[model samples]
Target: MISLKPRWRSTLEKHRAKSARTERSGSVRLRIVAWTFLLTSFIITGLIFTVREILISDVGRGANSSTESEIGEFRNFAQIGVNPQTARPFETLEDMLGSYVTRQYTGYKEQVIGLTPHQIIFLEEQDHYALTTGYRLHQDQALLTGLRENPSNSGIEQTPAGPVHWGKVAVELRTDQGTTTGHLLVLEYIQPELDAVQHTVFIMIWVGVAGLAFTLLVSWLIATQITKPIRNLRQVAEHINDKNFSGRVTVKGDDDVAAMSHTFNKMLDRLEEATLTERQFMDEVSHELRTPITIVRGHLELMERTEEQEQTLLLVDDELERMGRIVSDLLTLAKSERPDFVQPHPTEVSELMISLDSKVQVFANHRWIIADIAEGEVGLDEQRITQAMLQLAANAAQYSPSGSAITIGSEFYGQGGERQLKLWVQDRGPGVSPEDASILFERFRRNNAKNPATAKQHSMGAGLGLAIVRSIAEAHGGGVWIAAPEDGPGSIFGISLPAPSPPKKTQSITATYPPQNEPEKS
Candidate 1:
């Protein structure tokens, strides 16, 4: 059982009692934009940091390579390099060092210092000061003393020129006459490269900020476009009510959003139809029963003798029975909308039809025949399908001429996935017109005369029989329709069901008519 809880009446009243308010927009589009901007900003920051680290590392490595290269070049030069001016071995180590410094090139904020046990000397800016930070390193006694004391010569150190990578080599000036020992120092300034990396990172931060702003704006626009339709739907739904189901969502394209709008529109259509149906149902019922009810009441009140009273009572009983049948059919139609309306099982179609042919004969006096039997087992609600077929048979009996052949059978029609098992009743009667046939299964439609009525008198039914048949068929995932008469002046009422898969049992097929008074159950 479903729990029944009505919506808050106070909430509804409050909505109806108030006017719409204009407030700041609390839309999801902005939130998405904000998140996108934040996430992208973080990623940009990470990249900036990563790039800075990599560049700084590369700068450091370049400094080391410059220092090592300078030292290596000096070592080789001291051993073989001669003064280009003289084209001879230098008389002293200082001359060799000075000559080498004049010819060698140095990088940015880099310098070469030649030191001896007797004197400390270096290159000045006029010659190469731009590479030396213009610092008179030879005059910095403390740094010189520290370098002399420090045995390590291949690492960065805090010299007077700031942190610099420096390598020192002790070389023997191999002359044609003798050898002179001297110390050569290569100093590479790392500050300029570090500053360059910092500058690049600073520029990246500003670019990232600008790009983040652009991304935020673009994302906001896209999200707004995506949510516009949803907002429209919500606005329409807010004012929609049971009495007014006229709100239809606007569909713009063949996309998921359009599909959603179309589906919602369809739901509203069904709701409106159901509401109108319920509203008119009682009025129609009252109209149908009014005359019979008034006649029964009049007869009961005016009866004067025992014989007259008996006749009035019989007429009253017949009216009551008719009312009962109408009520029963209405109830059946209502129940058919429920999920449990049909209990389906595997059934042998041929045998079921043979059995139905027998029961059909008992509905009315007619030449009943088994036209065909679909030879297969199928999944269906046997009782409900039988009820629908019997209703069709009854319609035939009441509409066609007495003793006119009424054929009933099941056969397969259609192809592939659209295949169906069709159960039909064909009778020779004043067949329904094409336009009238369209609505024959709707409520309160009387059939073409059943079993040929007397020329002057034709009894009209409650008109719910075909409707009940339709309900039964629909409950089993099937449908009922009238086929255009192939033969003259007759109607073919068909109940179409979806074809079922292979059955568990393979039974032999047989087609035969049942006895008029009795339908043998399979």
Candidate 2:
């Protein structure tokens, strides 16, 4: 089961809370801009369609008015040609025609005359020329009459100037001659539709320029309004470092960002409260557990000398020792969980090893294979280091086959201009599986079935040795790891501690003592 203590759970939650503060401001701003652009485009499209329809209606009215004016001019010219009051056709003036057309008129003298074969001829008011030239006039009128057969021939064409749409209307007219063929009236109407096309194009160009400028201005305003609050939030968040979590985003007006800022503040408040509560609880638990164990150890010593019942005395001693180990492990776990647990001090590697070896010999039946126990000093907490080393030794001794060799050693390796001491404890026993190795240091993890002798003999321990070992290593700004032994026989558990700047003289430490009496049976 993967369960966390209250302290660790709180730490993990705070880490998650701090992690949520690192979202990209640019991405958020871009989303805001995208939404604004879409909204504006929708609104503008509706407005443009409505405005275009109104412009088209105005253009249609203007075209119709211009067409009507041209039709009125055509009617005026037709009225001048054929008199509306007397219903008489007007004659063409003499000096108003071209010379090329006058030469064709052979009836008159060789003189330039405006009258051509298609010229107007008078009919009703014939107080005009008598039969003196009647014969010539008859021939001329007859020729002109044949020429005026097609009178509705004028039509407009499209050109570079404009597209001219023209139509002719038929009207009644009276001629001086008896119903002359040329006397048919013509009324034409022309409207140049292409002229309106130029105006529409000019209006569209100006409208587009104005619309583009307006859109840019509006977009800028909207982006500023949206991104300003987010930028302020970013600055406030950047100021949050490893130590600080009190800073909060400024709450502006009642917008979405303001609401988010309020939520974020509440979250930080909860996170801080949780962090403080967990730390306090861990300290309290550690003290609580340690006090009873110290009292129990005191009581065990008192009873050891006076108790007469061997079984009762043994049982009490075993229970006291077991409870002591559990309390020690709990304290180590609490210390390791703290962020500021490391307290580096110079300690001799040789002394640390010797102390561990002495303790292992007291409990283990296996022989120790020591190597590379360098005569050097490293910066570390001596007590914590010794505790970790002892746990590793005990673990190796517990799992190794009877009479197997267990190696406890240390070496010096340099890293980042500082030497580190790597302390290792290896056992030549049935090697652990990789799956088991991963969680071997976890609290209460037992990789193999307990030996029957061990189950009956040492029933007090709750398998917290390796877990405490790991916690001690972590507290000293180091780590614990397990791997298959180099010789391919067993498992190797190691701790890495930073070396001291100035080496200390190596000295032999005092010998470790086992319980004076035989360990009480469970």
Best by lDDT: 1
User: How well is each residue in 99-159 modelled by candidate 1, as lDDT tens digits?
Assistant: 8776766645777888776766565552455344555455677887677667887777776
lDDT of 2 by residue, 1-522 (tens): 111111111122344456665452246556655676667666666666666666655555554444455445445654566434445545432212221222232221111112333553223222122243243222344433432454543333332223222323333334454332223212111222333544665676577657755776777678787877777777776666433467887788897888988887787777767766775786688789778878877876776454367777777777777777777676666666666555667777788777777777875578987766767666778877777787777767776777878887787766454767778888766666655665667777766644444454335667678777766775665666665544557767787666645645799976545544667566
TM-score of each: 0.49, 0.49
Every candidate's lDDT: 0.73, 0.57
Candidate 2: which pairs clash? 122-176, 122-177, 123-176, 123-177, 124-176, 379-500
The C-alpha RMSD in Å for every predicted model, in order, reads: 19.5, 18.4
Give the distance in Å from residue 155's predicted Cα in candidate 1 to where it truly belongs. 1.8
